[model samples]
Every structure is written in structure tokens, then in C-alpha cells.
Target: MQQYNSLRADYKFTEEEAKILKDLQPRMEELADQFIDEFYDYIWGFGQTAQFLKNKDIIAHHRKKIKEWFINLFCGKYDMPYFMYLYKIGEIHVKIGLPTHYVNSAFTFVRTFVLNSIEVHFHNKEQHLKEINAVEKIIDMNLDVLTSSYREEELSKFLSLSSFEKTILSGLKKFNSYVNLFLAGALALVAFFAIGLFVYDIYLLFFSDIGIEKGILTVLGSLLVLWAAIELIHEEINHLQGKGFAIGAFIMLAMAALIRKVLIYSLSSEKVDDLLIIGFVIVSLAIAYWLVGVKKKANSV
Candidate 1:
């Protein structure tokens, strides 16, 4: 489970077609045999896949059900009910401990299935072939959706883990925000100012002091500040529903503060050290943000 979670790097889907696929997956699973036979023939033609199919029973089993996931690409309408099917399919994969490599290889079978099906269905009709080609292009766009749904369904417990992480992160973010408003506002301000100060320190340390090689610690510090600013402003960008932006924001802010901390101690001034200590306090508060920021904000009913 941990391994699966680690493989997924927080992607999302918003298309109604993805929802449709989710809902229709179980029914498609029932038609797995039809898909399997076609897919096996297709895979057997490929030397690489043929080598992997040495175990006939195992190959047959996956072929029978992988088709369920294939047809799911054509299902439209995304909603909670549809997600239930996605979740179920994911559980099935998990129960069987499906290998990640096989998941990728299985897509090759799907592509062949789709192309072969279209080719055979419209071989004699040029007009039908053209139409089918266009539709197949759209289906290709949805390949990722089917893959994600299947993987998610296979790892159903991940939803719970994500939910728990989100809950803890949200509470932490909220509490940090309040603390920042009170005890860390000055600290944040000092850290902000320290960006320039660190740059000066870097210049002085290398040229004026005992020839210590100063890394781009100052530049890194500035970058962190810029990153945090970007996070705070990312949602205002048009057409961004705030999922990727939100996660990016959290990561940038944390990184900015961490880089700033490294800069603070690198300086020689007592005054700078004092400011850095304060900045550290603020950074600590900011880092705590992950605790509360994981969960999605509740929509008003």
C-alpha cells in the first residue's frame, strides 16, 4: 500500500467521461474474456510481451478482466456513484497485488484492442473508418483516466490514508496561520528582509573574509521567498481549480523557509543571527501548515 501511494504523485481528473468509465468498469469486467482473447492475440504478436506471457493461466486471468478497465474509457458522467465502481476495481487489483510493470504492459494490449477493433469494424467503409479514427483519438486521450481509476480501485485503502493525512495537515495549517498572525508576523517579516541581507553576507564572506567559498545560499534563499509568493498567488491564475496549485504552494512555502534557515546561520552578524532565530520560529509555524492543509475545504451546502 505504501509502495502504491509512493508511485502516485497526486494527479486528478475532471472529465465526465472519466466518471462514466468508473461506473461502467464492473460491467466491463464481466466482458473481460472477449477483450482477453483479442488482447492475447495482439500481445503474442509482440516478442517482448510474449516472453512475459509464459504463464498461460496468469495471462488468461488478467486478460479476462483487463478488458473491463479498457471499456471504462468510454463511460461518461463522473460522480460519487461512478467513483464507487472505480474504488471497487482498484480493490480487486490490490487484492491480487498487481505488479506495476504489468499495469503499464497491459495498456499495450488495450491499444491493440482498440486499433484492431476499429480496423475490423470499419475496414470496408472509408467514411466509417475516418469517424472511428477520430473517436479513437479521443479514447487515447482517456487512457490515463482508465489507468488511474484502475490503480485507485486496486488501492482503495489509499483514500483513507490520504484522508487522514489531509485531516492532520489541515488542522496544522489552520493552527499555524493563527500563530503566524500573532507571534510570527514579525518573524516572517524579518525572514523576508533577510533575503537581501543574506546576499550581502554571501558577497562579504567570499571577498572580504578568509576566502570561504559561499555557495549560492543567498540565491537559494531568495528563490524560496519567490516560491512562497508564487504559492500564495497561484490560485488566482485562470482555469486552475486549485488542486495542483494548492499542493505546489505548500511545498514551495516549506522549501522557501528551509532555505532561508540555512542562510540565516551562514551569516556572521549577531543582529543577523537574532533575526534568523526569529525567522526560524516563523519557519517552524509555516512548516506546521501541512498538518491542516491536506483536506479539501468543505463546500457550503
Candidate 2:
């Protein structure tokens, strides 16, 4: 109750705003079905929606609940029970392992849908503006309460851990941070060496007895490897900034290095077996990299 009051206060959701929302309830009820239909269409585009709304019965129940929730948004009954209702929905979301990303995205759709509906139905500019403000505040407040469940879930898990376990977790996080730093440094060195390798290839091309064709191929191969190294470094930086670790980048580096070997070995007929082995490895790495990308996309959805 206190937390709900705090949220309402923070959003400046006054009694007048509540009355404004209540006044809009009839219109919202009329549009509820349209909102749910469009909502399903939007979530279905996520690709993983089937995993959640697996059966017709489940989908029907979910649709009903969503409609009720939508209508209740303008119920003008912002109280402990209302906030608790939202929190319970959030808890269910957490229990089902639903990503916070989906919650946020869904809320985005809801906000846009309601605002657009308001624009179409309300003609008085001043009243429309007031209703929009009230609606936005209430929706934001709802999202806040909903996401708080996730936060509380994480906090509870941490609180439940033994002191020693907590200490170990903290130490592991610190160690992981250090390891990422070390990896960044190592990638820097790899990029440096790659540059040197490219330079050396250029030197060999111009100064050595290598044929122009072979020399140019070697320099191009070196450049490819150098590009792969730089890409890996970029990926590592993104990981440090809280993105996923780019396993695909490492695979790319391996493929690039093997491809460089292939270019060099292709110059020697006697190295046919070596070339075949490298080619096979490169193909395998390509498939692995593709699979990593597919998995990442799925997880994001």
C-alpha cells in the first residue's frame, strides 16, 4: 500500500487524473476487443509466442484476462488491490521465465494503442490532452509495479543466499570482470600482431621472390585475418558493455585464420590434404557461427 502510494505520488497521479481515467472507461471498454486482437497480432510476430500461448484454452483464458486488465486500466480504482493485481501478473511472468524485454515491448504496444484510440475518440483538445496525460501516467505506474516483481524476485534470491555463498558470488563476479578485462587486453594484442602480420606480408610481397599472384593473395589473406581480429575486439567491447559474449566472433576468427592457411596452401599442390582439412574446418566453423547467430536471435525474441 505504501509502495503503491509512493508510485502514484511519483507519477503525480492525482484524484482528478483518476476521475479523468474513469470518465474514459466506457470508451476503453468499447475498444477492448480491438486492442486484444491487435495485441495478439503483435505478440505473435515475436516468433516465440506459441511457446507461451501453447493451447487454445490457455490462449482464450489469457485473452479474457488481458481484456479485463485493459478495461480496468481506466477503472479509476488505483489502490492497494489494483497495484497488488499488477504485481501478481508480474510474478506470473517471472515464474514462466518471461523476459523483461517482452513485458516492456508489450507495454509499448499498449501505450501506443490507447493513445491512438484516445486521439480518434476525443475531439476536445484540452480534454484529450488531460486524458492522455492520465493514461500515460497510469500505464507507466502499472509497468513500474509489474517490473518491481522481477526486482523483488532477484532481491529475494540474493537475500536467501548464505553469507558465504553471497561472498563467493561477489568474488566470482569480480573475477569474471577481471577475466573480461584480460580478454580485452589479449584481443588488443592479437590485433597488434595481426597488423604486424599484415605489414610483414606486404614486405614479403614487395621484397621477396614470391610471385605477384601468390604475394597478393597472401596479403589479402593477411588482411582478412586482420579484419577478423578487429571484429572480435569490437565484439569484446560490446560484451564488456553488457551485450552477449560473441561466440560467433571467435568462430569467425578461426575461420579467417584457416582460410588464410587455405590461400597459402592452395599455392602448393603437395599440400592438397592440408588444404582439404583446413577447408573442412572452415565449413564446420561457419555452421557453428550460423547456429550461434540463430540462437542469439531466438533468445532476443
Candidate 3:
């Protein structure tokens, strides 16, 4: 019913269609492995998809898995758990950066194979129409739900990219692509040295400046600042490489800096106003993050 509500609402899947599918289960079981072999042979013939199946061992293994999955689709038991499983499949595709167009095109191939097989097997035109319609509806339902997962994943990437886009437009606009690349390389080198300094500061704190609590605080705070810069440098690298920005990552970095400040000095400092201001800033940042989420949701709608 979960799958029904989420996907079948569009397809109008009925118990009759479900029964037709289940009745074909035996034939599907018989043909699945053979069909999948032929299907994959076609896919493997193409360089674009064969590249993803780099491992030879997984080729047969995944073929078997796809056969099983394909047969189970006609098991007449589609539900929330089934939807969840398909959702995970979609997420894996997104995680691997599979293009959505490839997903749609692959579904078309499967749909044609199954529908043509049905047409050949059934004798009565009306019965053939009925059964094929059931198959077509179910395939479409699967596509709808699966593609929705892809869309959700793309939306997330889009949101993160918007942040990176803003940063690139703000600072890198004056520089050509080559100059931007040069600046990123230069900053990356600086970040590497800063990390080295951070490591050296650690040596100073423990061995060279033992028992000096303020010295330890200074060293710790410096390390934290360097880490923050390193985070920005990574963002810059991703920008240059045309990757999406993770805006929330920066928020976490900011929170880390605040926590470090409080840990190293603010907690023990005698200034009440300073502590109050820090508290206020933390609260404001939390509120701001929440508001951004709300606004993003609104904008998406």
C-alpha cells in the first residue's frame, strides 16, 4: 500500500493487473535468467555502460541479481518494503553519478523486451492487451518512483551547487579560468604549509611548552583556525573541479571554531559580556541555519 500510495496513485494499479502479473510469474521465472543474459550482453556491448562494470566477476553475479529482482517485480506483493528497496537502488545510482537519461533509456529497453515477449506468447488480442497493459503500468510505476529518487538526489546536489556557484561568482569572477586555477593551486600550497605548522604547533604545546596553559590554548586555537582555512581550501578545490558546494559543511566548521574558542579560553575567561556574546552568536547561527532550511523548502515548493 505504501508503494501503491507513492507510485500507483499515478498508474492506478488494480488487483486485476496484479493478478495478471502474478499469473505470469512462472513464465517470468523461466525466462528471467536468459533474458537478463541477453540484456546484459547488449549493455556490455556498449562502452558507456561497460565501463561501470570494471570487475569481470561481478558481471555474472549482478546478472543473477537482476534476474531475481526482475522476477520478483511480478511477485504480486509490491509494498512499502519493496519501495524502500528500489529507493536504495536509486540512491546507489545517484551515488555512483549515473546519468538519469541512462536510467530512462535502460527502462525503455527492458519494457520493450518484456512487452514484445508478452505479445509473442499470448494468443487472444484482448487478453494480450490486458496483460501487456498490466506490465506497462507496473514498469511505469517503477520508473516514476525510481526517477523521483533521482530527482531528490539531484535537488540536494543543486542546493549545494548554488552555494559554490555564489562563492565562485563573488570572488573568482575577475579571474579567468587559468588565473582561478593558479590561485587555487597557490592557496592549496599555503593550506598544506598551514597544516604543517599546525602539526609543529602540536609539538611545541606538548614538549616545548608543557605546563603553560595559555600557550596550549594559543596553539590549540591556531590549529583550529588552520583547520578552518583547510576546509575553505578544499571548497575552493571542489569549485575548480566543478563539484557541488556543501554549504552545511561550512556551518559545521563555524561551529567547530566556536567550540574551540570556548574550550581554549572563553570557558575560563572572566569577561561575562564576552561569554554572553558568544552564547548569542551561537544561538543566532542555529536560528539562521533553521531559517535557511525552511526558506529552501519554500523555494523548492
Candidate 4:
């Protein structure tokens, strides 16, 4: 991680590079939006993911999250803190059994989009051609480092397979990769939809008289987003065998539910019964830890 920062620190964008960035921001945003839009279509196209897509509600939840992910990247805050945040994202994706190939493919699609957009943006401007190439190289290099970090962590784990076992493991890995890829894509879609609803609800608040209906819809969307997040966290925990992380995830979900309820009831002049949601989330998560985490560890012996 420190090495990654050092690479970025020494390779900061120059003035000419900054010009390329300025020229590309809008086009980048547009491409990012389309990349997110088509993510699900690609993911669901695979049969492995279709297994999880059996649950319509879960599928919808996943689509919403994907949208939020794309929007966040385009928010114009690519500082050190943002980079560190991305590092954790890479770590989490690896922990969840995401394949390096899919990550590579996803980024390749993004890079192609941006490069083509740049070609169109600077159609006849031969003067800044060198700067465009430099900027594209920087972006590609940065993404390469990110992908490398994720792959390194993923491949670092010992699978403990013999030649015969390797064949079985490879087949299993192929299936699992498809499953996680689809799951990741579906999750992105759900997050995106939720974000769209959230923004639209906010807009209606000031411009229209749909507060009550919009508030209800917003609360529902928020719950769906939180639920989808917990499901993703659970999947990651299952992969990593980290009950503690799963516990923390449930706690965060409980807190989110409580906070949302509090805000919802605030406008109604009614008392919010947060205790039930908190207690339920805690008890359920604790039971899950005992059943899945502790039991699995004990049985492994």
C-alpha cells in the first residue's frame, strides 16, 4: 500500500497532464455512466450468476449498488484519501473471491471508453496529442497497479492442491469466478438504482409536493441498499472466515436502520422504536456467527 502511494506521489500529474484531465473529465463521466449501465447485462449473461438471479429482489438490490459506485468515482475527489479508500475496495473485492480476469475486463472496458472519448474530444487538435497519450498512460498505469494489488492478495492464499486436486480446484474456481462476477455486477446495479431514487426524492422535496410518498419510497430504497450491503458483507465473510468482520457489518446495518427510522419519525412527531430493529439485527447476527462461524471452525478439525 505504501509502495502504491509512493508511485502516485512521484508520478503526480504535470501541468500538461492536468490539461488532459480537464479535457477528459466530462467524457469520463459519460463513459462511466454507460459502463455502469451495461455492467449487469454482461454479468447476468453468464449462467453461473443466473443461479443467484433466481431471487428477483436480490437482483434488483444489486443493480442499485452498482449505480452508486459509478457516481462516486466521478465526484471529483481523487486525492490520497480517495486512493486509500480504493485500496480497501480492492482488498474487499479480493476477499470476496472476485477473479482478476473480471477486474481486468471491467477496467479494460472503462479504458477503451475513455480513450475513444478522448479521440472524439480532441478530434483535430494535433497540438495536445502528446498530452492525451501521457494522460491515458497515467490512467492505465494507475489501474494496472490497482489490479496488480488485488491479484497479488488473491493469489497469495494457499490452495493446497495436488496435480489431480488442481484439476478439480480449477473447475471449481471457474464456476465460483462466474458466480462472484455476476454478484458483483448485480450489486452495482442495485446501488445505482438506489442512488437515483435517492436523488429524485430529494429533488421532489423542493420542487414538488410529493414529500410523503417520496419519503416513504426513499426509506424503502435505503433499507434495500442496506440489506444488499449486508448480503455482500456476508458473502465476503463466508469467503474469508472472518466472523468478527461479519459482526461489525451487522452492527453497521443495525445502526443505519436505527438512524433512518429516527429521521423518518422526526417529521411525524412520533417516537421511533429503534430498539426492536437494533435488537433484532444484533441477535440475528450473533446467532449467524455462532452457527456459521464458530461451528464451521470447530468442524474443520
Candidate 5:
């Protein structure tokens, strides 16, 4: 519910700082592309960071957005809408699973870029120190607004849940907590056995009574089902711990379960209609998953 007016109070952003930043508008616009390229190029140097952006189209699309944001920073309108937009940038980054370290690192990078630009363009002039001061303030304000929004967005989740539900989770008795711990241990044991079954799966495929054709499909199917089971146990444990599981994982687990079904039914006595239904379920889940991912990416910073 907080607006730019309230948020600005936290950063002490003033009209003087805004006016100074506005003066840099044309200069910022001129160097926007250079800034963006340097930013992404630095990001690309890190293999793990580059991997998520493997899609050329995704990279290009985001590159354009970053440049626009860079240019707009000097537009001098650090009002409510601008604040919300910046907040969305942070939220989207969270939605897509980007870690907090990257967020902090990126802001540091941008702060350096702005400070360097100020130093280079206004070197030794009377206004040089003033410009640097203004730039520093604005960038620091941006970092505050953006990172705070990310935390607030996540905090809102815990806030919105029912108090009764929260009470139930927090009120666990010693006996109940111990029981859940025991259940978690049992699930881990099952998961360990599941891994061993994978080795047995190979044995069944090549050397057991099941012939190659049937063995391959059935064994793979069984392994997938076991994997799905393990995933469920993980989520259940997460639920017990009050950490909540992501819906994204469940979608993937469902897809895996369906694929396992198809693998099993392909070689067995299953009706064609049932196979078709399973295929339909898979396609539906896949479409849902794709839509969810796109929604996340679009909303992500």
C-alpha cells in the first residue's frame, strides 16, 4: 500500500537531486546502449549467470528493457509510478529465481557506472562534486527502493496467509514435531532406496527376465514414478517445516508422472483412450507450465 511519497521519505530523495539528475538526461540517453552492453557483457562473463539467459531471444528482449530503464533514470521523475515500476523490476527478478547476491551485485555495478559517468563528464568543474553527489544519492535511492520492494513482495505472502493457519503451524506439540521428523527420516530412506532402484532399473533393462523392449520402457517409467514420489516427499517435508513448496516444482512433477505413465502404457495392455487422456493431461500441464514461466519472466526484472 506504500506509495512513492511514503517510500521517498525513507531515502530522503529531494527536488534538488531530481533536478540534477534531470540535467543528465541527454547524456544518459547517449550512453544508455554502452551502459547496457557493458552491464550484460559483465554478466555474460559469469557462466552460471549466462546459462539462464541461454535463449538469445530472452537476452535480446531483456537487453532492450535494461537500456530503456537506464535512459529513463535521468528523466528526473522519481515519483510513485517510477517507484512501482522499479519495484516490479525487483519482483520479477525474484519470480524468475535470481538470487539476492546477483541483485546486490547488479546495483553495485550500476552505481559504479553512474559514478564513473559523472566523474568523466564533469571532471574538475565547480559542479563536478555536486553532480557526483546527486548521482550517488539517486543510485543509492534506487537500490533502496528496488531491494526493499523485493523483500516486501515476499513478505506480503506471509502477511496474507490466515492467522489461524499460521497458528496451527506454529503451535506444533513436541510429540507432533517429533513425529514429523520421523516422517522426514522415513521419506529420506525411501529416496535412498529409490536411488538404489535406479541401479536395479538398469539390471532389469539388460539382464533380468524383462526383455529389452519392455524392460527399457517399464524400468524408465518406474524410475520416473519413484522420482515423482521423492519430489512429493520433499514438498511435504517443506510444508511441515512451514517453508512452502513452489508450484512450479509440482507442475514438473506432474509432467514427470504423466511421462512415466506413458512409458509404462506404451508396452502394456492399456486402452488407447486412456493413453490419449494421459497425453492430453501432459499437454495441458505443459501448456500451464509454459504459461506460468512466461508470466514469471514477463513480471521478472
Candidate 6:
């Protein structure tokens, strides 16, 4: 209750805003079905909706809950019960392992939907602006409470851990951070060497007695390796910034290196067996890379 009051105060959500929302309740109730229908359409685009909704019964129940929640959004009763209801919903989301991304994205759709509905229904400019502001505050507050569950969940887990365990966990986290930094540094070095390799390839192409065709192919292969190294470096940087580890980037580097070998090996008929092996390895890496991408996409959804 204290926290709820703090949230309301933080948003400066007052009785006036609540009354304004209450005034909009009837219109919102009328559009509840439409909101649910469109909401389903929007969430379905996430591609993993079925993973949560599962059967028709579950989906039907979910739809009903969503419609109810949508209507309640405008209930204009920003009291302990209302906020408690939101907290419970957030707990359910955390229990079901729903990604906070989905929650945030779903709120975005709700905000846009309600604002558009307001524009279509409201005529008075002043009242329209007031309603919009109130709706925005409510929506933002709801999102804040919802995401807070995830934060609290993490906090509780840490709190539950023994002091020694907490110390170990903290150390492991720092070690992981350091490891990621090391990887980023290593990738930088790899990129530097790749640049040198590219430069050397170019030098050999221009100054050496190598055949023009082989020289061009070698340089192109070197460029491919260099490009892959740069991409890996970019991926590592993103990982350090809290993005997923990019296994695909490492696979790409391997494939690029093998492809360069293939380009050079193809010049010598005697290296046909080696070329075949490299081709097989590249194909395997390609498959692994594709799988990694698919997994990442699924996880994001």
C-alpha cells in the first residue's frame, strides 16, 4: 500500500486524473472487444504467442482476462486494490517466465490503442488533451508496476541466497564481466590481425609473381575473413552492452577462414581433398549459424 502510494505520487496521479479516466470508462468498455481483438493480432505477430496461449481454452481465458484488464484501465480507481491487482498480474507474468520485453511491447500497443480511441471519440480539445495525459500516466504507471515484479523477483532470489552464496554469485558475475571484456579485447586483436592479413594479401596481389586470378581470389578471401572479424568484434561489443552472445558471429568467422582456404586451395588440384573437407566444414558452420539465429529469434519472441 505504501509502495502504491509512492507510485501514484511519483506519477503525480491525482483524483482529477482518476476522475478524467472514470469519465472515459464507458467509451473504453465499448471498445474493449475491439481492443482485445487487435491486441491478439498484435501479440500473434510475436510468433511465440502459441507457446504461452497453448490450447483454445487457455487462449479464451486469456482473452477474457485481457478484455477485463483493458476495461479496468479506465476504471479511474487508482486505489490500493487497483495497484495490488496490477502487482498480481505482474507476478503471474514473472511466474510464467514472460519476457519483460513482451510486457513493455504489449503496453506500447495499449498506449497507442487507447490514445487513438481517445482521438476518435473525444471532441473538446482541452478535455481531449487532459484525457490523453491521464491515460498516459495510468499506462506508464501500470508498466512500471508490471516491470517491478521482474526486479523484485531478482531481488528476492538474491535475498534468498545464503551470504556465502551471494558472495560467490557476486564474484561469478564480476568474473563473467571480466571474461566478456577479455573476449572483446581478443576480438579487437583478431580484427587487427585480420586487417594486417588483408593488407599483406593486397601487397602480394600487386607486388608478387602470383597469377592474377589466384591473387585476386586470395585477396577476396582475405577481405571476407577481415569482414567476418569486424562483424565478430561488433557482436562482442553488443554482448558487452547486455545483448545475447553472438555465436553466429564466431561461426561466420570460421566459415570465412575456411572459405579463404578453399579459395587458395582451389588453385592447386592436389588440394582437392582439402577443399572438399573445408566445404563440408563451411556447410556445417552455416547450418549452426542458421540454428543460432533461429534460436535467438525464438528467444526474443
Winning candidate number (lDDT) = 2
Deviation in angstroms for 237 in model 5? 25
lDDT of 6 by residue, 179-278 (tens): 9999889888988998899999889988999989999999999999999999999988888888888889999999999999998999898998888888
lDDT for 83 in candidate 5 is 78
* C-alpha RMSD values across all candidates: 14.3, 1.4, 17.3, 22.1, 10.7, 2.1
- Candidate 3: segments with Cα more than 4 A from true spot: 1-4, 160-301
- Could you tell which candidate, 2 or 4, scores higher by lDDT? 2
For candidate 1, write residues 156-210 as lDDT tens digits. Answer: 6546667778788779979865754553354446556656665775676676743
Q: TM-scores for all candidates?
A: 0.31, 0.95, 0.52, 0.41, 0.53, 0.91
Flag the better candidate by lDDT, 5 or 6: 6
- Which regions of candidate 5 deviate over 4 angstroms? 124-126, 168-301
lDDT per residue as tens, model 2, 222-265:
99999999999999999999998899999999999998888888
Candidate 2 CA-lDDT value: 0.93
Q: What is the Cα-based TM-score of model 5?
A: 0.53
Best by TM-score: 2
Tell me the lDDT of model 3 at 260.
60
Q: Report the Cα lDDT for candidate 1.
A: 0.54
lDDT of 6: 0.91
Compare candidates 1 and 4 on TM-score and give the better one.
Answer: 4
Instruction: Report lDDT per candidate.
Output: 0.54, 0.93, 0.74, 0.59, 0.77, 0.91
lDDT by residue (tens digit), candidate 4, 1-301 = 5666565446664556555565556666666657666776666544356544467797777666556554444444455675666666667656665666666666665556555666765646674576466556565544656576676664554354476777888889899767766765765565576567567666766677768664765556476555756575566546445233344444444455555554555554344455456456656766665676665465333
Q: Sorted on lDDT, highest at the top, how do the candidates line up?
A: 2, 6, 5, 3, 4, 1
Query: Which residue pairs clash in candidate 2?
Result: none
- Residue 31's lDDT within candidate 1 is 56
The TM-score measured for candidate 2 stands at 0.95
Better of 1 and 5 by TM-score: 5
Name the better of 1 and 6 by lDDT: 6
